[model samples]
Target: MEKIVISESNYQIRKARIVRTKKLTPLETLFEIVLDGDRSLDHEPGQFIMVSLFGIGEAPISVASSPTMRDSFEICVRAVGRVTKALHALDAGDEIGIRGPYGKGFPIRIFEGNDLLIVAGGLGIAPLRSLIQYVLDNRRDFGKAHLLLGCKTPQDILFADELDQWRRRMDVQSEYIVDRAEQDWTGPVGLITTLIPGVHLEPERTFGVVVGPPVMYKFVIKELLAKNIPEHQIILSFERHMKCGMGKCGRCQIQNIYTCQDGPVFRYSAVKHMSEAF
Candidate 1:
């Protein structure tokens, strides 16, 4: 089978300018950007965009902003490679090239009226942020929502302002977990999976969207299943080494699926049989 091309000739950057760039931690930089024309990114919650650093290279980055915000989009980039490091050096008002709002985003509409359990770890919170914000912007569209966040330490938390907002919201339950803490930190200190047991949910009506390092899912999904969440109801997004945002690069292939094309997001039942997917 061939692949579905999201853009015929790769959409032009259309002049995206950085509105804000923050270094959340030693490894990550958060970019708040607007398409130069101020157009809607028109992305689904879990889809990704291909960002090009001319004369350097391109990489697939998840659109980290909620689709509900039509004017601009965001992506959290971790500096593990050259292109990412170059992106880190850019500042507000600096222009960058972009293509797509591609692949699948979380199935926000399907999970609309249903309860949702969001599990994020490390930089996993980046992509999950889109859905989490969407749910908040349209609180009445979904049932009870619970977010379980885990990171290396207190200083590693992302979207501090947004996390505070979610904490104060009446419709959502939010938990923050850390692997270790200093005296100034006071929160659950453990793996994110520990928070799952305490959430009140009807597994059948709930979808668990888990995003994290590939190593994190096996344990986290096992915990969600033990709590009676159906395998199919478990939603997951994978992190991969992506080259082209278009499927042709073959850099993001995970067995028969291209993490860049077939998914960055997939239902657990769809990949439960594919051990390569985490």
Candidate 2:
């Protein structure tokens, strides 16, 4: 019988070193990493990579930086579980294993020349940050851009400094809200959906990109639909718990579709029929 040899590249783990670390919040820490030989992650906005530690297991983390930043890439980790807690404990100069920048990412070409309505809730901003940064870098390629951000509290907001920079940009329209207000918080107090109603855009030329918790989708999508945006123009990211980045694991399967391979980013019209997608 002939021997069938499998390629190791599919499961190859590259060694990467952390160059910097920033404590975004008490629970979330951001790591700036560079691969061996200064290799760029070269990932698209909304794509994720599997981060591994020797003794501890690996977890899938979305690429938080846009591909425009060629020097290095970033991943924002929240200390929620065993692997993430361990990841949070590491500091700059630490070494880790990196497998891939897997899954489908946001389609930038299709969104070109169209106004963008980007909505992020809580930790969902991590992935959407990639797309936002890309748009900012290539601002001339797109039309009007709007950012609607929601966090639990003032302390829970990630990238505070960058968020302020975004708000200051005359080219971008940015609005924020918090579920509960702290003494220092002077912004609107309510759900993210509340900001959607006041946004002014041409539905035919607007594209709505949303990333957030499962519960946020139902309400947010409803609001987007009410804005008269076409179903095909509404895009979403479903960050499911994918055990293996490849399609073989079946961990991120939504019915027959693999969220890890087929999605994590999907159009509203494409997955609207799938009850589990939202």
Candidate 3:
């Protein structure tokens, strides 16, 4: 195994090699990367890293793989902008710049021993994938694990194989919904909020972690609250325009909080009043 001493410099950009790549969709590509000298990212479940393409610039990409997989980490990138488009053009063995496993991640420590109800919508599944993998890796640590996922169409589903495994796994109760379905898609169809009504959970003992687009949050939170989950128990991972992994830049600021530092993940109670947070 390759070994590397983790760097402490916030500005230091480590060289990372793309060990594997899979084209999940025309627009999205999954890249499995490992740092030079094999240094582990050593990040928490929901933390994100700033991926740089040299002259192209840097973008904050979530660590899609779990920390349990110590050999490497993964990021699912969608080709929406310049840097990400360049990232999509890279092949295996290509190198990219990386800095930080920045910001606070999901509070897995607090979720321990509590039943977990995780919700992911569209690309939101990318970050939640880290948490799901960690929970499954240490399956015995929690009570019950339930996953609720929704996407625009069947082709938009992120991890088909892993989703199937989770659905079939006796340990996790998983259900997926899609707004529109292809003829071959046989899964549940509707908004993700639809799945919440049928879930069997003890509200007081459950910690609900949600990650999705802005429009999805209010509806999902409403359903989670209807189930009686506490305000603090409802966690959310927000996807905002984060520039500069450090808090210096105001791009990711919502009121007084910096999404890049204070959070990308927050307890709903903390952001409920922040109009910018949505």
Error of 2 at 195 (Å): 0.7
- Pairs in steric clash, model 3: none
Q: Write the residue-wise lDDT of candidate 3 on 1-278 in tens digits.
A: 11223346756899999999999988899999999999998999999999999899999999999999998999999999999999999999999999998888998889999999999998999999999999999998998999999999998988888898888999999999999987888888889999998999999999999998999999999999999999999999988887787777799988888888888899999989997789
lDDT (CA) per prediction: 0.86, 0.91, 0.91
Native-vs-model 3 lDDT? 0.91
Give a tens-digit lDDT track for model 2, residues 99-158.
888878898999999999999999999999999999999999999999999999988999
Off by over 4 Å in 2: 1-10
Q: Against the true structure, what is each candidate's TM-score?
A: 0.95, 0.96, 0.96
Which residues of candidate 1, in runs, are more than 4 Å off? Answer: 1-5, 9-13
Note the residue pairs that clash in candidate 1. Answer: 46-105, 46-106, 47-105
Give the higher-lDDT candidate: 1 or 3: 3
lDDT of 2: 0.91
